[model samples]
Target: MLKLLYNKKASAALANLSVGGRLPHAILFEGPQGCGKKLAADIAAQYALCEGEQKPCGVCSQCVKVERHTHPDLRYFTVPAGKKEFPIDLVRQLRQEAYIAPNEGCCKVYVIDQAHAMNASAQNALLKIIEEPPAHARFILLCENRSMMLPTILSRVTAIELELPTVEQCAQALASLRPQNSPEERQAAASGAGGNIGRALSLLETGKPARAMADAKKLCELLIFADRYQPLEILAGYDKDREGLLAMLPLLKGMFAQIAVSHYAKTGRDERVCNRVTPAQALDAAQAVEAAVRQAGQNVNIPLLCALMVERAKQALH
Candidate 1:
């Protein structure tokens, strides 16, 4: 069964394409990371090759193969590990492959993961294939941003934009994925991840959410009153795992969000448990951390992100 969260606009639009008996030769599934662009691309590929009366009837051979990544007609390209960009030569090879007939289906589906990773040269190389795709060829370009794409490339493909899922939605999805986790634990993990299911799952599976929360809380307290380099010293623990570092930022945001929430309570809340900082300060700190995370996605160096984040948090909280 294929289920997605918080992407109704794209669902309705893509559904219309299949129901109306027309499918585009090239599609750009543009969205932030972990927003299910790749998942939607997989579903579209299966829908195109499904032979059943209802397209993407999951039990069909085509749908099953796509699910298992065993489909002969589906081709996927991604930047190899340690490579920052999708090489231009790969695009040239893909252009050659687009003309070939499908091994078992009506069309050849090429799914490009992280099209933003395709530098200018690589994107220019891909421009021709997308501009004049073969009759039996379909392309899905999974991207975090479309602004990086060439205007010529943008003009040729159907664009399916996806937005982030809500915290409640992320929590619900986490419950299904990890029934072993208690509802409270799942909710905590979900909130800590700021509605990114992939990050929440990473935190849960590695048993790092609780640890990250404790550490982030400590860092916040230290920022309120500690040595100048203390916050950076704490951040150095996450140098080896980028995802752990990523999760730490949101969990820290969650901490400040809690502070913001508690700051407004009338009389009964414990200010000690939530921090003594004003709501405005807490909110400012949260926004700073968010900005740092955004920069990290744009290829900011990890050391710089850590230094910037620590300094920002210290300034806002202190």
Candidate 2:
């Protein structure tokens, strides 16, 4: 399963554990969304259940069952949608199930995805299970942001940080998935995905890459031209989708960085496209844009954020 994609750090960690017998009973895999944390956890679970001397032998009955999500000892949990928190009752049920002997394997594996979504009470309830998990039980917690989870939960588990893949790697992986797409299409998808394979695939699945790319391109033009009219127009595009606006700010900042780098490389020094701006102007613009992106995560008003970004970009162009 590790070979199915490139996760060098996780692959190496698992290999080292298999050889040294230092594997932890509980683990927390943290990373940006759509980077394949769940896939890695599934691979680890299969390794734990493999019967032969070689773990995760794809042909082994245990591995096959796990692959099919039919392994009796493998349980999965996730926070339900529309609810702001995981209920304590769910954690209590898992704790009860943890003590029962594995019906078909040497270990019982529980994977809890979106663990950060758990509220304080639910987290505390799960903390007890982590503190004294059954001898044959193993738990894997997956979260997009470790900081959102309780420190007590973090302190008890071996944490693995997954990073977004490089653009080249993401392009290659995405190309394989879209066998019919042209090279240019694949490259565009990869760039727009920003190293997230799941997001790349999602864009492909929704047939939204073309639209997303168009939006990104327009955004770039607005930043470059310092058009006073563009921000209001952009705000209209984002007004109906508050959540999308929050996600898009980082992508815009990244695009601005790319533009700045290109400008620097070509000129050997920063020069404002518009009259009277300085290198410091460009730097300040980038920093302000990025800060606004971070601030959006804190629930700042979207229109206000967009207005600030436009004003900063215009200042940089002066």
Candidate 3:
């Protein structure tokens, strides 16, 4: 499985567990959204079920069943569609299911994606089972942040933080997935994706490398100008492509940070591309941009927020 591509730290952790036979009953995989935490959990589950010394023997029945999601002992839990929280009912059902002995594998694996989305009551219900899980049951709690979870929950399980793969690794993996693409195209997509493999594949599939790069360049230019007209243009463009705008937030933020640091180094004082301003001024501009980003996440009118951000940027520049 692609889990073999896990970063060195995560791979070493798993290897240590396998060799020492000291795998925890519950493991929390915390990382950025597309960093392959779920894949690693699945690999660990397969290892737990493998009949041979090496795990995830693709030919083995257990491995096949786990991959197919038909394994009686392997249970998967995720937030319901369109819902922001994991319902207590799901936790109760899982509690009942956990008691059942493994049907076809040596261990029963339960994978909870977005575990932080569980409400307080749901978390409490889960805490009970986690504190005293069945001998054959194993839990994988996948979260983007540990702070979102209860302190009690955080204390029980082992935590594994997944880091984004290197650009070369991301490019190689993307190439393997899209063998039809030219090497240059694959490389461009990988670099544009900014270490996100899923995004890299999406960009490749949709042939959006040129558009993404163009958008990034334009955004940088707008920041450099720090003018009134450009913010309106950016806002209009963002309104026309909300998804793309949202996807580019982190990239824009990174660029601004780089500009801030470079300006500081060059001038011996904090300045960003937006203006020859103090560090605090640049930070204010960044924060304003971040607020606009948060508004976009709330489904606010992108154009309106963009306009507001542009006005703020103009003020900061002056």
lDDT preference between candidates 2 and 3, better one? 3
Candidate 1 C-alpha lDDT tens digits along 209-314: 6666677778767776686598888888877656556556766776677678876778766666456578888898888888876765566777788898878877
- Tell me how many clashing residue pairs each candidate has: 0, 2, 0
Regions more than 4 Å wrong, model 2: 2-4, 20-22, 210-318
* Residue-pair clashes, model 1: 0
Overall local distance difference test of candidate 1 = 0.81
Inter-residue clash pairs, candidate 2 = 276-318, 277-318
Q: How would you encode candidate 2's per-residue C-alpha lDDT over 1-318 as one tens digit per residue?
A: 334376789777766565643357888888888788888788878778888667667778888888888999999988777777767788889889999999989889999988988888989999999998889999999999999889999999988888788767988987777878655455556655666888867766654455545565577567666476875686567666544454455555655665556555655433444233344665666776777766665667877877887877777755
What's the distance in Å from true for residue 199, model 2?
1.3
Candidate 3 global CA lDDT score:
0.74
Off by over 4 Å in 3: 20-22, 56-58, 210-318
Each candidate: what lDDT? 0.81, 0.73, 0.74
Residue 293's lDDT within candidate 3 is: 66
Candidate with top lDDT is 1
Ranking the candidates on lDDT from highest down gives 1, 3, 2
* TM-score quality measure for candidate 3: 0.65
